[model samples]
Target chain A: MDIDTLDLIDQYLRGNLSDTEKEAFEKRIAIEEDLQEEVLIHQQLLAIHEQEKISLTNTSYQQELVQMNEILNEEDNAKLSQKIRAIGKNQQPHTTVRFKRKKTVNWFYSAAASIVVLISLFFIFNTPKALPDYYQNYVNWEELPSFTVKGDPEELFEKGEVFFKNKEYKNAVATLSIIEPEDKWYPFALLYLGASYDQLNENEAAIATFQKLASLTTSEEYSKGYWYQLLLYLKTNQKEKALEMKTKILENPNHYKYKEATELDF
Target chain B: MENTERYIQALIQGEDQIIQEIYKKIYPKVLAFILYNKGNEDDALDVFHDALMYIIITQKEKRSVILSFEAYLFVICKNIWKKNLKNKVIQTDVLTLEEKETNLSAFILEQQCFEFYIAKFSLLSENCKDILSSYFNGLSYEEITLANAYATVNTVRQRVFKCRSKLIELIKNDKEFQKIIKWGA
Candidate 1:
């Protein structure tokens, strides 16, 4: 801690000490605990100083940034900026805000007649209801883990997955159904099976598969079955059943699709 | 990683195809982060541009291999935006291109100080760091000795005192330390 000790430590660090002096200092350092501590501090501080010196003097990195920016910002590189801007725009939340039109034309008979016609049309058109485009809006199929088939030496599930992804629902169903029901992949097979049926407009088969899957309470995929069943019921114009399913989901706040169910307009 | 190197190489070479792919894939993440942190699309674009340039230039100068390109790029963009948000001049909705450049350079200078500390600290001896960490974790000298398996309690006490004084001395004499003090004030 004293100046002489500090000076000795500094000399040792800089290799300024003669061989005899350095040897003597090491011997003393072994017995003198304070010397070891001082030596370590001096060595560390010097290392820090050397690092800082290098960093402060290295100005090329900063210049490179400016140069690279100029290159990227060149007029011809406008396409790059446009691509980035498009990406930014695409990432914005897609919330379609529908504005209800005010009924300014208030002639009583016409309004009443229009209301009745609208009600009748609503009932007629609401059955299929375009299925709410859940495939586009909710199903991020690529993000889902692929079904790993046990003893699938032929990679049948891989073919099914590719078929499903490519909109070949019939092929997906046929390939997926080849896996036996007792196989570990049966549950996942059922998922794509139901989805493929849904895609193919075979609502009864989709509903049946989803119903069976829903009953498998211990499987992690149980929630998907309940959800798809609710969706299929809606698609099949079974409003009462869909409502019951929604209520069942809402009964437990922990339901996977509880939030989506709560937000369902129908 | 190969993916990291590919991105870095793309930046260095200014390959338009790979760079466009980078923009399409990674820019969304930067945009989301910026939006979550109270920045608009323009602010996010500015930060992303600067961060990309920073990476490109850093690769050309240092050629250091980043462990994760996406994560590293996000951190750089985060730092730049944070500094931008804190700048008094940024209260104005619009900045001229020259003003933007000046502001960015100021951020880079500020960030260099942080980089200096991280680089230096990472180079410290593990034993020295452990002693300092133990003391800060509120371990007594006897506890530290027991934890570190030192020969005696006195050795721990000596190491603790040594580390503390060394830390103080390093901080006091650090070039960035003075800049940080001024900036805080």
Candidate 2:
């Protein structure tokens, strides 16, 4: 399509055209098959502009699930193989084949039991220990350098910090998010904002916030944003993503968490 | 009918108890279907999980469903498995992350336009991408101008028009896009 047609379509899609122009465009669309297709494409693009972000979050969520399934599969298969070997040793070849076929139901029951126990143990043992160290070891709000801002923006940041310190994370998110990205405190606000999202169990939002920090900042906090992201992935049990972040952090030794990332077991 | 909506809500919210119930209810049939279709147990598990996620995303986007949830889910799983089979014939390696996104989204959408649009969008200049994203995200032309440090609303509007034109041109000229339109038709 020509630029004029494209411009016209853009105006129409945005409802920028006058009523007469819209009527004319609609009439043209009715008669021209190619124009109808172009309009359809424009509509799809407009609809999808917001969708891509959600799609990405959903994809991340799916990948985490897929990775969990792989881990479960590995453990389950190992147990099954061990059981099959044990059955083989105890029985004749013909009897072993029969036993294997009959034992499928029992195997599933045992696997389910194992998974439940494993999950219980993970929550009981791992969750409490991992989070404090992940947050406390790296984060010291008092030590953070204050960014230069004044008046309403500074007051907003102070209010946000108060909410954060009081553990009112939802309020903190709502308050902190109002600070403009161009403000001096924006990056630091993002740090708190991301942590608040993490506390709220909004993993995708937290990850995206940290990502915005990594991309938008140029100071030491740029790498610190990524470090926090690595920690968030670990907290969420997304080992694959944690490992991916670890690689990115370790790529530059000067990265704020490079040494800490190197010490990670994964 | 209530069960259908409840199950879909469970999927959307990632409610573990209900999601577990869903798995227990659906896995046997999914496994049987896959095994009958020459897939192994692992493929069944993978396809089942993929289908669930696909449903979650589609429901989030579209919010309207005609079929019952289980039937909708099963159809998606079957289609994904069949598509995977075709891909396996062409390449022995497993689908890469991008290929998986393209295929899964394409299957859910019943068209390949999602990936194509994303690819075209990525090829634009970063300024264009940012301006368009802000615009499409419901920022006013004035808001976009302020955010991007453009001189005026008119400048932002012109930039958006030019960038969108470029994006459309890129989409319209792509050979794969033509194929997608034809295939969808």
Query: Quick one: best lDDT, which candidate?
Result: 2
- Give the per-residue lDDT of model 2 (tens digit) for B3-122: 888988876665666766666556545654664466665566667766776666656655754357777677767767877786688887776755655555545544235656877898
* Per-residue C-alpha lDDT of model 1 across residues A1-266, encoded as one tens digit per residue: 65357557767877889999999999998998656655654454454444322222224545644654565556644454455445445434332111122122223234223321111111222333344443334443343345433343235555566678878775566456655666655677788888888887888988998988888778766776777788788777677888888887888777756777786656
lDDT of 1 by residue, B1-185 (tens): 88899988876666767777776557755654555456666777788877876675456656765788888888889888867776635476678876776555555554655565455455557887778666544466688888879999877766766665666466557665554333322
Residue-wise C-alpha lDDT for candidate 2, range A84-197, written one tens digit per residue: 223323221111000011111223233223321111111122334554445434444343333323332325565566667777775566556655677656777888888887
Q: Report the error of model 2 at residue A140, Å.
A: 29
Q: What is the C-alpha RMSD of each candidate to the true structure, in Å?
A: 18.4, 21.7
Worst 10 residues of 2 chain A by lDDT: A93-102
Report the Cα lDDT for residue B46, model 1: 83
DockQ of each: 0.07, 0.08
Interface RMSD of each: 13.2, 18.4
Q: Which segments of candidate 1 are over 4 A away from where they belong?
A: A1-266, B88-90, B125-127, B130-157, B160-185
CAPRI classification of candidate 2: incorrect
How accurately is candidate 1 docked according to DockQ? 0.07
Lowest lDDT 10-residue stretch of candidate 1 chain B: B176-185
